[model samples]
Target: MPRARLHDVAEWTADGHRYRAELSAYLPRPALATGGPVLGTDVDLPSSWWADLREALAATAAVATTRTTVRQQWIDRHFTRLLGIPAPAIAWTTGHGDLHFANLTGPPLVICDWEGWGRIPVGFDAGLLHAYSLLRAGTAARIRRELAHVLDTPTGRAGELVALAQLLQVTARGGHPDLAPHLARHAERLTAMPVP
Candidate 1:
């Protein structure tokens, strides 16, 4: 897998609006051919695609993150507001903070957008991916099957909780209305804490 390496950063003001620009090396792969700009549309992915993603997640989990990057606290707030108080000492792992389809490229399986990478809830990345796939039940089921080991664990459930809670938060702000109910249902089911 290859990432677009940042080579330069510059900030300037134009038309009274502050703007920052980043110059990065280009990768050959285009973004995934999914329908939405941020989330993946329904697609029939081969088993190998999920396997490649699993491999990448496994490799990424080993990476260490700085204090500035751990995302658990924000996740906790979301989880607690929805689920009951979260389990104590939930585990964390390093992975792309945004694992939606738009940030990933396929056939060869390349995850992109590194600036958003950081330590996240252990199963959060996979759960986020699965959450995005909720529009299509088959794709969501495949994610569950491929990531069952992670999403089924106590820590993984916390990860899924974060994903669900965050998604619900987004829906509350007028995003993904179609997905709002699905997110709430899953949150209730996974957290066993009843979503209001």
Candidate 2:
């Protein structure tokens, strides 16, 4: 959670549209990935980085907020339809709704992009990261291993299915063709149902 202090903020109307701009402290570290949200290749990260990430996520989860990242209605509608399984009871907690390699940085470990932070299923962040890491078996495995406490429960599995459904939907729209089959297989393994 290497967040910078916001020094200033401004808002204005431009041609019937509202716009905003903010000045904040700069982060010196570069993001872990620059290409995209999905990590297509393995990255060498130190063990300490993993520990720091776990701590940051835990700290985030402890914060109080009224915002929501994923709603219950969407879960109800998509869980069974997209995952081919009944939606399990979800345990909600604060999370970084979009937790991919692209949003993370460092041996210092900075989590960037705060817009989507809100209440989500307990393991949503870890699940989202795992989904992004699917292309790299080793990295994917490491994520599961490192985040086991968050990702090895019923609610966690539900959260992961939610993430998979999202990625699969992206595929349905002709995005991430290379990642589609892997997502399908992972879904199959999770629910024991064939996914296309």
Q: lDDT values of the candidates?
A: 0.75, 0.86
Return the TM-score for each candidate structure: 0.82, 0.90
RMSD of 1: 3.3
1-196 in candidate 2: lDDT tens per residue? 6666678889999999988777777988778878888886787899999999999999999999999998889888777777777888888999999999999888688887776789998888998899888899999999999999988988887788888887788888899788888889989998899874
Q: Could you tell me which 10 consecutive residues in candidate 2 have the lowest summed lDDT? A: 1-10
Clashes in predicted model 2 = 0
Which portions of model 2 show Cα errors greater than 4 Å? 9-22
Best by lDDT: 2
Q: Write the per-residue lDDT of candidate 1 for residues 32-126, one digit (tens) a residue.
A: 64555335456677889888888889888888877334465676566677655554466888878788777777666777776667878788888
